[model samples]
Target chain A: MQPFTYERPADVAAALAAIGKPGAKFLGGGTNLLDLMKVDAETPQHLVDVSRLPLAQISDEEGGLRIGATVTNSDLAGDPRVRERYPVLSRAVLNGASGQLRNQATTGGNLLQRTRCYYFYDPSMPCNKRVPGSGCSALKGYNRIHAVLGASDACIAVHPSDMAVALAVLDAEVEVQSASGQRRIKIADFHRLPEAAPEKDTILGNGELITAVILPPAPPGGQIYRKVRDRASYDFALVSVAAVVETEGDRIRSARIAMGGVAHKPWRAFEAERRLAGAVLSDDAFAAAGEAAVKGAVGRGHNDFKIPLAARTVARALTDAAAQKKA
Target chain B: MRNTSVTRRGLFGGGAALGATLQSGSALAQSPPPGAGAPPVDVSLKVNGAQHELRLDPRTTLLDALREHLALTGTKKGCDHGQCGACTVLIDGIRKNSCLNLALSCDDLEITTIEGLGREEALHPVQTAFVEHDGFQCGFCTPGQICSAVGMLAELKRGLPSAVTPELAAAAMEVAETEVRERMSGNICRCAAYPNIVAAILDAAGKA
Candidate 1:
């Protein structure tokens, strides 16, 4: 890791000012940033330590919860309100990295973590995400974990966050602070596809610090997050699904779905949700919803299996979610 | 000792003097010069029960700080990345991978490593359980596994849920075999002693 100057700012104003310069990053949890630094993939000259800032609280908003950015993944998952109201988010956080990593990873850092693409980690490899316009080795070389949807010729790296998938279904909003002012970016518009600029993962401007994630009232239904990985535990997902289904008698009243490990961002299945609305809850309808979810999915050679896997995951997640007893 | 200060220059000088007294090559004798890279930053670490003030390169990881600087070698460095749990330590009673944490970021935090768990004569209960169950083979990953188990039990006691927990909204969960396996998935034993490790953890959990 390159040696860098460090500062721990006590307030958000100071933090934003400290990171206003070039080659400066707000260090929340060093789980991803430090790892990237050790491999020379990310080399920031100055670090403004914001992990110790007073943004670790989880407070109840009007009808929802506002989670501070620095809240550790463990705390967020263990929060009673989250587990009771947003079990999908709790399960998604638990389905991520192991106990140790989750204990150190922050809510904001997890959203902004870099892709797990092997090419991105290796400095010698040609990765547009690591260095824009250089080249994308994942396009043709060992593309198993590459994106299968919303991918472009420039890059195919997928976002490796499970929490974001849940957030997408929950309609979470990110509160950010900058030197100029404050703004809120809806979770759907927060992350971006790998169109031409894979280096820019999110729409967050330079030196914008994530303050909190405001979740609206929990969707009125049974929520579930299902992750399929190579291993039973402690592994990244090959494909995952987060689904919220509300049933009225035997018909689906409303549905929201999102998928991970399948696209550059958490792929919100808006079409699938539309197809499921007012449809009779049945295997055939669920299968059709799954098919609608991957309508435009295009897979690279090594990752073609993810297409079918993602469809099945969506169907299974919906089936289980529909069967769950609502609170 | 509390607040024992060790500058980069003085640390190297002390290493040279100690090497000369022993007349042998030492790990510290081969370290890079103080003037090589970035300027050292003052970091105070409260490890085990002692607080030591040392000036370290900002890039130095907490794992290196424990093993190399403070001479607390029980916290082994396996992958140097967060992939392996060999660098696991308790910061404010929560287990974290020390390799992923910078020494400067951990200033003034309470860090508990394996050496702080128990003395040689009186071992921590988790350590004794590992011994009784033969939870390890080569024992390279033992320190991290032990520390992780200690922390895992604390989490379970506080009603933390795991990936396999059937109901997320449950107030509390029973520590079962599957729960132990899922919770300890971070620590990898290359020897494949997972059965014994799981058994020892369950036994310890019963006593915890």
Candidate 2:
């Protein structure tokens, strides 16, 4: 951690002004920023504290659940309305981090948490995310938990939030406020792939503050979040599944599925969902959907197992979601 | 009685002097105080019922603040990274990773550490249960485990969902042993004393 100026702004306007400078960073939960600072991955000249601002509200506005970006992961998961209206989001939030981390981490910060690539955390090791174009050591060394989707020659780190996967499944939108104005970005576009510039993680501009996340209500049906990891707790996913299925009269009417621990952004299983729509969701349909989801998955030597594991995880998630209809 | 009073008075005087020096030395020296009021910045955190104002680099973590600055060294630093929950604490009644938290940002929040849970004569229920169950062996992760258990109980009381929860039903039920294990999974014990840890938490929750 380095010596830097700190300011606690009362509102969004002040916070934006505080971080409008070239080298300032917005401090939300400090779960990510403070950890990065310890190893010196992020050395901002100033820290704009947005925790105190009244940005921790979760309310039902016209659009859907208006989840204040600073709302803690614990609160978001525990909120009755969120659970009732959007269990996928709640399950996603709970699957991430741990009970302690979920308590302190903000929804906005969770989506923006840096890659868990061990090489990125160690400055001595070359990683394009930490120091762009320096090199990608995870490409070869200790690449088991690296990525199997959304890879470029420059980087192949997986986006690490379970909540982001659920958001992608629901087609949530992010509300960002900046010095200039406010804008809403689809959850998929909010996070970017490596794509030559692996350093740029989110579409958020230099001074933009994530205000809230707007969730479009889940269609009447079932939702499930399933994660496969080395440990049942506190570990990042090897492959995770977030699926919402609307079944009508023994057939799948509509489906939205996204994957985590396997891609750069929440890996939307669009092809898989397309295959399931209007088809009776039997064992064969789910297997085909799972296959479709991982059709283009390319894997490194250590992580080749993710291709099948992710497919199975997605298939199991759909089965689980469908079972909820009967329960 | 007179001999004991004399020793107690002497210790009090030394403690008071140390506290005063820690608070006042920085501004006069034009350099950051020995550990007090200098900048980068001086942060006053109300941790476990004590007010500690210390001069630190803006990036100093709350875990460092508790262990290094105030000497409430119960909170262990395992990974230093947020991946491990060894530095878990309760700020405003919610569990958080103190290593991933900045000391200055916690200025106005209520912080609870393992020290706050017990003394030589008395123990918090969680601490007592841990002892009874032999929940820990090396004892390195006890502080974080206890703090995390407290947070886990609160989450269950609030009806928070877990990955295993089939749905977000509002039904109030005993936090099952399996639920406790899944919820507290973040705090890893290399010793693999999880079965006892779960037993302790279940016993504590019954009392809580």
Candidate 3:
């Protein structure tokens, strides 16, 4: 790991003011940042410790919840309010990382986490995302974990976040703080595609810090997040789907769908959502909706299996949500 | 966020750093930060029940600080990366991968290691359970597994749900086999002691 000076900021202002300096990064849980640092992938001159910056609060708002940036993954998953009001959010978070990692990973850090592309993490490999224009080894190498949607010539790394997928479906908002002040970005727009700048994950400019994520009221529907992977646990998703659907008798009244491990961002299935509306809640309808979700998906050789796998996972997620018994 | 130089606030603990630095066998006190990277800074860490302050390079991970700086070698380093759970330890009573944590970031927080878990005479329930069930083989991943199980039990006790838990709002979720496997999924046992490990944790928690 590159040697760096670490400071524990006293408050948000001090953290924000100190963070925008050239090589400084706000240290949240250090679950991802430190791992990246050890690989020499992300070398910062200084790490502004914001772990103690009073951002760990999870408060109830009008009809939603405001999760502070520093709220550990475990806390978010365990919080009763989150579990009852936003079960999908809690489920998504629980499916990610390990127990110990979750205990230390923060909400903001989870949002800011980079992809788990084998080539990207391998310092010796020529990954365009790691070093622009160098070359993309995953394009022609072992990329079983690479993206199958919204991929560009520059890069094809999938955004490895399950929580982002759930948040996208819940229509959450991210509260961000910077030198200019505070702003809220819709969860759907928080993460970007790896079109030309795979190196950049989110739109937060230099010195911008994520303070909290505001989850809108849970929709009137059964919510579910299903992650399909090789192993039962501690593994990244091959294809994960977050589905929330409101059914009017046997017909779908409304729906929201998003997927992970399939694209550079949490791939929102707008097509699927549109298809499911007013459609009969049947296996065929869900299968079609799943097909719509991955319509433009082009699978790399190594990940070609994901196109159908994603479609199936999407359908399964919808089925689970639809079958959810209303209490 | 292109890389640029910036400074941050550090929680400085007075008095103990000198003593801890002198105590480490590596003589880390000698790293002058002569070339490359940042120089070593004073760090104060409270491990188990003792406070040890030392001057260390800011990049030093809590795992290294425990296994190297403090010479508390019980916390093993597996995949220095966060993928493996060998470096699991309790920070402020919460299980965390010490390997993925920076020592400096943990200032003023309490850390519990395998050393603090239990001794031979009076082992923690989880530790005794592992022994009773023969939960390990090579023992490389035992410390992390134990620490993580302890944390998992506490989480369940707090009504924390898992992916397998059907109802997130259910109070006092039961510890079923699937729940145990999913919650303990983070700790990988190459020795395939999973069944026994699960049995051990279950027996310890009295949920078996």
Candidate 4:
């Protein structure tokens, strides 16, 4: 890893001021950043450590759960209220990384984690997301884990976050701070697809720091986060789904769905949600909704399996959500 | 530990020693980018109840600091990239990957490695269970496995649920065999000694 200045700023203002310089990056859990640095994929000259900031609490505010950006993944997953009220968020976080990594990884860092694309992490390979205009290696070379939903000419990498998928379905919003003032950005607008610029992952400005993630009160229903990976443990998702459904007797009153490991960002399954409304929460309904979710999903040679696999995973998630016990 | 108001420890620890380390250095940085920090940063850590201070590069990982700087080699480093739990340690009583943690970021944290688990005369219950069950084969991953088990038990004591946990609202989650496997899935053993490892953890949790 390259040498870098480490600053533990006192307040949010100091942290913002310190990172205003060039080649500076906010150091959140250091799990993804350090691993990327070790591979020479990212070389930030200054690290503004924001993990120690006094913003690690999870409280009920803003009409729902207000999760501080620095709240450790383990803490978030283990919080009783979260398990009781928003099981999807807890389950999604538990599905990610490892126990040791989750203990250190923070909520905001998990949202900002980069893709697990093999080509993107390789400095020797030409990845447009790593270096703009360099051409995407995953576009043609060993592209099993490349994006299936959103892909521009420049990049085809998937966003590797299970928690973000759940948050997307839960109607979450991010609270951020810049010199001007604090702002709230909806979860859907926080992450951008690789349409033109693949280098920038989130809409967060250089000097801005994420303060908290505000989740609206969970809908009256069951929630489930299901991930399908190569291995039973410690592997990135091939396809994952976060599904929440409110049923009026056997018919679904409302539904929210989002997918991960198949797109540049968490792909909201709006069509599936629309199909689910006023439908029975049955196997046939789930299967059709799953098909609707992946309607236009394209696949590379090796990952052509993911198309059907994604549909199956979606169906499984919906079934699991529907089977969730009455609270 | 507050960085604002220029606490006395902060001023002396960062400003004074930084110049000395930069000038009369000990092979300061390996791959120093042109704009990287020129001076080594001073950090204080309490490992196994002993307070130790060292000046190291800002990028040094907590695992390297333990193995290299402090010579506490009990914590093993497997796949350095947080995938394998061989580098697991207790940071402020929570299990975390030391390899993924920067030493400078853990200034005020209290760390517990395998060495801190127990002494020779009296072994930690988990260590005893591992030995009784023959939980390891190569023994390379034992330190981390033991440390992780200790921390995991604490998590379970607080009623954290695993993926396989059937009842989320259960008063106290049962440490069933499958629950043990799901909880210990992060600590991968290339030797495939999972059966014994799970048994040993279940025994320890049962004993506790």
Candidate 5:
């Protein structure tokens, strides 16, 4: 790693101020930032260590749970309140990374984690997301794990977060702090679509620091998280589903559906949610919802498998949630 | 510092008494204190029971610092990318990939490596069980596997649930084979020694 200035601030306000400087980045758990530094992927001139800030707290609020941005994945998953009330959030976090990573990775950093696209990590490759106008290598290269939804002509990278998919399904809110002050953004809008600007990832402005994430109270009833992957663990999802449903008898009262490993962001299946909201839970309804979820999916040669896999995952998750409700 | 005086007196008397009783071929009782050159970069490390205050590079990783600087070579570095668990160690009782962690980050913390597992007369159950079950081939990833298992056991004891766990709110449940394999997925053994490793860990947990 190159020589750089390091600062350990005392509090969040000072830490935010220090990170607002030109070319300054906040160091949370250093899982991603430090790895990038070692390979010279991201070379920040200054590092503002925000690890000591008291932002690791998880508190119960009137509206919902306020998870400090610095809360480690392990702590969040292990929290009694989180597990008791928001099981989807806990399950999503547990499915990500590894034991060591879960202990070091913060909630904010997990959401802001870059895609695990191989080309993007290797600077020698021509990745438009890594370098603007450089062209996308995955377009013609190995794209088995690339995006099949909401992908642009310039980039086909998929977001590598399972927790973000759950958050999107839970309708969470992200609180950000900057020089101007604090702002709240809905989880669905936090991640940007890779349209013309594939390089830009999040909605946060430059010099903005993620302060906390507020998970609004979950809707009544059953929730299920199912992630399909090549390996059992410590690997990114091939296709994952976060589904929560409320039903009266066999009729669905309401439903929220989101997908991962198939899009640049947590791809919310708004149409699927609409299809299942007032419909009855059955094989026909599940098939229809799955079809609606991938109605606009455009698959590449290497990622064509994801279309069927994602649709199947949505269907399986819905079936499992219905079974859980029956029990 | 005053305790040094009594310790020096005791050392002198003991040295004189054992001088003739020891074998002539044996080397000196004291190894030369590492050449007093510029105070070895003043790194204070409390690894296991011993405390080391040495000088070293600022960029050294904890894995390198343990294997090279301190000569505690029990920790092994596999991929060095934090992907392989062959360099796992406990910093303040929390398992971490030593290869990816900087030594400077562990200034005031307690570090426990494989060397701290057991002595010649007594073996930590995990270490003894690994030997009995043939839980290694090249043995490169064994140290990390054992260390990570130690941390994993601690997590389970605290009622921390895994993704595969059916119920997140349950406590003190049996650790099934599938759950163990899933929890230990972070460590990779090239020799395909996972079956024996899981057996050894299960045996140790049963004993505990």
Candidate 6:
């Protein structure tokens, strides 16, 4: 890791001011940033330590919960309200990383975490995400973990976050603070595709600090998050699904779905949700919803298996959610 | 007895020598060389019930601070990344990978490493269980595994759920073998002593 100055600001205003310098980054939890620094992937000259800031609370909002940015993954997952109301989010948080990592990873840091693309981590390799316009090695190189949706010719790296997938389905909103003012971005518009700029992971402007994630009232349904990985634990997802299905007797009243490990961002299956609404709850209906989810999926050579895997994962998650007792 | 004495003296002498090198703040103390970067900063660390005031490069990780400066070698550096849990330590009663944490970021935090866990005569129950179960072969990842298990048991006692927990909304969870395995998945044992390690944790959990 490169030598850097560290500052623990007392407030958000100070944090924003401290990050105004060039090559400065907000250090929250330091799980991903510090790891990338050790490998020389991230070299910041100044680090504003925001982990100790007062942004660690989970407060009850109007009919919902507002999670502070620095809330550790463990705390978020263990929160009683989250487990009872947004069980899908709780499960998605637990399905990621392991006990130690979850304890150190913050909500904002997890959302801003870079792709785990093997090529991105290796400075020796040519990765467009690391250095834009340099070239994308994952396009033709080993890309078993690359994107199958919302991919562009510039890059195919997927957003390596399970929590974001759940948040997408929950219609969460991100509250961010900048030197100028504050703004709330819909979760769907928060993360961007790897169109021409893979280096820019999210729509977060420079020096914009994420303050909180506001989750709306839990949908009236059964929520489930199902992940398929190479291992049963501690591995990144190959394909994961976060689904909320509300059934009216034998028919589905509403449905919301989001997929991970298949796109540059948490791929919200809007089409699939549209198809499932008011449709009869059956295997054939669920299968069609799954098919609709991956309508425009384009799988690279090594990752062609992910397209079908993602579709099946969506179907399975919806099935499980439908079978579960509604909240 | 003579061999044990020699080994103990050698370990202490090596620790003293490393301590001298660190205290001097030579460029050698900063691995990979800072290359005209920020100066050293004062950091107060409370580790294993002892307070130490040290000046360290901002780039130094908690793992390096514990091992190189404080000479706490029990918290091994396996991958020097978060991938391996060899540097697992308890910060504010929560288990975290020390390798991924910046030493400066952990200033004034309560850090408990393996050495702080138990003494030779009065071993922690988890350590005792590991011994009885023969939970290790080469014993490289033992320190991290023990610390992680201790922290994990605390989490379990607090009703923290794991990925394998059948019901997310359950008020409480049982500490089954699957739960232990899933919870301890961060610590990688290259020796493949998982079966014995799982047995040890279960035994410790029962006793706890």
Give TM-scores for every candidate, taking all chains together and pairing residue i with residue i.
0.94, 0.90, 0.92, 0.92, 0.89, 0.94
Q: Report the C-alpha lDDT of model 5 over A52-136, residue by residue, as the tens digit.
A: 6889999888668999999999999999888877788899989998897787789998888888888887766787887889999
Question: Model 1 chain B — which ten-residue stretch has the worst lDDT?
Answer: B24-33
Among residues 3 or more apart in sequence or in different chains, the pairs in candidate 4 whose N, CA or C atoms overlap within 3 Å are none
lDDT of 1: 0.91
Residue-by-residue lDDT tens digits, candidate 5, B1-208: 1134455545754685566346334332221122321222446788987888766654457887887667777899787778888999988888888877666556778899989977868987888889999999999999899989888888888888888888787766457887788788889999999999999988888764
Clashing pairs in 5: B40-B55, B41-B55
DockQ of each: 0.44, 0.40, 0.41, 0.37, 0.17, 0.50
Better of 4 and 6 by lDDT: 6
* Superior candidate under lDDT, 1 versus 2: 1
User: After superposing candidate 1, which stretches have Cα over 4 Å from the reference?
Assistant: B1-35
User: Tens digits of per-residue lDDT for model 6 on A21-104?
Assistant: 889999998888888887778888899999988999999998999999999999999999999999999999999998999999
True interface contacts reproduced, per candidate: 0.75, 0.76, 0.82, 0.65, 0.31, 0.82
The list of candidate 6 runs beyond 4 A from truth reads B1-36
lDDT per residue, candidate 2, B1-208, as tens digits?
1124445545764686577567655432222223342265778999889887787777678987787667777999899877778899999888888998888899889999999877868998889999999999999999999999988888788777776775466666358887888888889899999999999999999775
lDDT by residue for model 4 over A59-92, one digit each (tens)? 9995689999999998898888888889898888
Q: lDDT tens string, model 3, A168-220?
A: 99999999998898999998889988888888888888889999999887789
Please provide, for model 6 over B49-89, each residue's C-alpha lDDT reduced to its tens digit, 9 standing for 90 to 100.
89988888788789988986887989998998788899999
Residue A45's lDDT within candidate 2 is: 73
Q: Which structure among the candidates has the greatest DockQ? A: 6
Query: What does the lDDT read for residue A23 in candidate 2?
Result: 76
lDDT of 5: 0.82
Worst 10 residues of 5 chain B by lDDT: B29-38
How much lDDT does each candidate structure score? Answer: 0.91, 0.83, 0.86, 0.86, 0.82, 0.91
| Candidate 6 chain A minimal-lDDT segment of 10 residues | A34-43
Candidate 3 residue-wise lDDT at B20: 44
